[model samples]
Target: MQLQTIVPIKPLGNPINYKAKIVNIGSCFAVNMAQRLQYYQFQNTINPLGILFHPEAISRLLEFVVNDKVFTQEDVFQHNEIWSCFDAHSDLNQLEQEDIIEQLNSKICRFKANVFDATHIILTFGTAWVYRNKQSNQIVANCHKVPQNQFEKELLAVETCLENLKKIEQNLRQINPNIQIIYTISPVRHIKDGFVENQRSKAHLIAALHEYLEKNKPLNYYFPSYELLMDELRDYRFFGKDLIHPNDLAVDYIWQKFVETCIHSNEIPTMKMVDEVQKGLVHRSFNPYSDAHQQFLDKLAQKIDVLLEQYPFMNFR
Candidate 1:
């Protein structure tokens, strides 16, 4: 007797209209994806804190971008709350929690009220781990030198995470019921958790998330970000020196895959020079300092100078 093995296939939904505004949240990989979408001229916004509260620095970073100012390394670092150099002079931990909460509420309200009209929300879950504040009994974006042992412990169950996501969706759906949601898991490993534990944690998350996606209906979708990174580009060369995060090449590969799979077509708008550079990088022939490449760099510099002249608020110099 011959036996047939049946494979369950996910339904291929209708192609997403490229006209919608997209909001990306979650991890650094989500940030990379957002950047590519913005480069391609899609109406896109990236929430640096994901579902968490926004920091003051992130607001300033968005202000700079909206004004067409050139973003500097310092600006990026500040936006992400990395204070290695400046921490010596300032007690970043002393920033008022109430003020942060107010700012975050204001921004979230604005997005929900004005930006949710025709938006697709893409959420990435980095990990189940979270740090709670002892004083308020609330989860925080960062621990900020607060004694870890003082806080009550909680690891977000998959159900809790899914409920939070559904709440976010419901809030947006109030403004626009047609809103779509995409979920992805960050492939970047948390090496601080130790190799064996890290793998175990990721396995638990993936399994839980996959089960949730399978049970949920069409309003929510799961993108294979984890699979693409782990299965398609598993080579060590694709990762950075950290051996956790994807290097530039790997990032580009994932971005390209996203464009193909999610964006729907290659006809999306992109800067001509950026397109050229991307093609060069894909073929492994990009030389930033090359004479011909310098021409494009010069043009980009000229554009930046014009922007700097126009927006005196940006103090990149």
Candidate 2:
């Protein structure tokens, strides 16, 4: 009867609903959850600066948004003939200096706009280990394939992680005092850092995050994403071929748990309806001109029209 241990999750005080303005940031796992939110047609924005893996990188992003920092030629550099910014993920890189600068500034503007009105902000931290550029004496978000000799690898201390967490909260609250923050530690393991090293990194992040939550209380909520994967779904089957990232099935299971705890009960019907429409949209008709297929298309169109009528923000196209 008790084959597995469940990670008991409590219902959120201010659970997300159709009306909630959501913005997700941090690790690639955050993108997983954001994909689910997007599928359900929720008002969600994700990773404008791209996938930031550590707390300090996230803090730097928030600092840029809060301080209205402008990007210039000096902020970006060329490596392997591709221009990149040390403060952002490679997803934002471009072929020219002006293009990258413009892209970064544009994304920052978008992030600032969304965050100022965001009701719920989700942050997922991937590691405490970071690469500090020896020349700049600063931690970079992404190394961008730079030579390893140019950077110093170091583990961020618990105190520094805690400080970054607090600063993130303070900065967000300053922009939108009513914003509720949800924090989760990424479940993906960085085995390249070495097995023991990865464990130490996660421990530091977990300790610092919990300490910050315990001290600050309700402005922040901790979701045990790490525990759920490592404990509840403790099987190799739940992981991708890399044996690091959670597979699609595991992400679906975790997302279901997230819905049960963090999403509003009233929105379940809408979510189900959205799921149906999504599946119907992708359904293939074996016969191109069959009456049955036409009827199915009609039903799908009706569902889309109804949802769009109720939630104008939703786009089935």
Candidate 3:
């Protein structure tokens, strides 16, 4: 007897292959998919500026890239001896003003180039809740651990989120008209936002996203990542220690589903070969100098060489 109800996924017409250049952005869950793609040796980029949880933060990033905006000292601030930009995650924060500005500009330049060349763009929206800086009256991507009183916490309305989604689409289409956009709601629970409030936040995001997808069907698709976790893997066992994020097993399950629907079937063999090489590369023999170990290393090298012969971009080093 079937124990779990599977989330039905429709295959994409233009499925991703080894040659596809993929850009993954948005919440932390985006990194999970990107990591899987990277392990398979696919061309992929993820959150160059940093993980952005909401649509407004994501839209602002795209706008900055499209407009070729340069980051200056005015765009960043100093707090607790760390220089951080309101537009970027704390991972990009630096100890000095010039360093942070340079880092932001560098990321923007790289991300802009990636967008122009991207064949597929995957966006994972995490929440509708956002924090706006009281002084600037602007929604900040991250507060950078500033004083709580400095920002006004707010939940974005469906209409406002929809506008940001449309803007994101417009900016992406402007850069590359043929790029396919795949959208998904992140499965990670924002328990800090309160259980009921978290559900409301997700409701607003889903409503707005569905509206946007309904209006722009061509070259746009929605993946049921949120449904997969909440409906199919509906158990606390799928969650991590914090009980908020999906554990590795859950991520792998969702990734397999993604592969079945989104990835080109022809790339499976190549992906398997890549996985073999990856596993062999990390293998350690007790006797490093043994003839058997040397032979194993030689065989691994040969496998790498064969793969590189066809896909020169597939670097095992």
CA lDDT of every candidate: 0.56, 0.95, 0.95
Residue-by-residue lDDT tens digits, candidate 3, 1-317: 99999888989878999889999999999999999999999999999889999999999999999999999879999999999999999999899999999999999999999999999999999999999999999999998889989999999999999999989999999999999999999999999999999999999999999988888999999999999999999999999999999999999999999999999999999999999999999998999999999999999999899999988888777
The superposed Cα distance between candidate 1 and the true structure at residue 258, in angstroms, equals 1.0
User: In model 1, which range of ten residues has the least summed lDDT?
Assistant: 85-94
TM-score of each: 0.65, 0.99, 0.99
RMSD to native, candidate 3? 0.8
Q: Write the per-residue lDDT of candidate 1 for residues 86-164, one digit (tens) a residue.
A: 1111223214444444444444455544334545777766665655657666555555444568566445665665555
Output the worst ten-in-a-row residue range by lDDT, candidate 3: 308-317
Model 3 segments beyond 4 Å from truth? Answer: none
Residue-level lDDT of model 2, residues 1-317, one tens digit each, is 89999999988899999999999999999999999999999999999989999999999999999999999988999999999999999999899899999999999998999999999999999999999999899999999999999999999999999999988998898789989999999999999999999999999999999989888887689899999999999999999999999999999999999999999999999999999999998888899699999999999999999999999999988
Candidate 3 lDDT score at position 54: 95
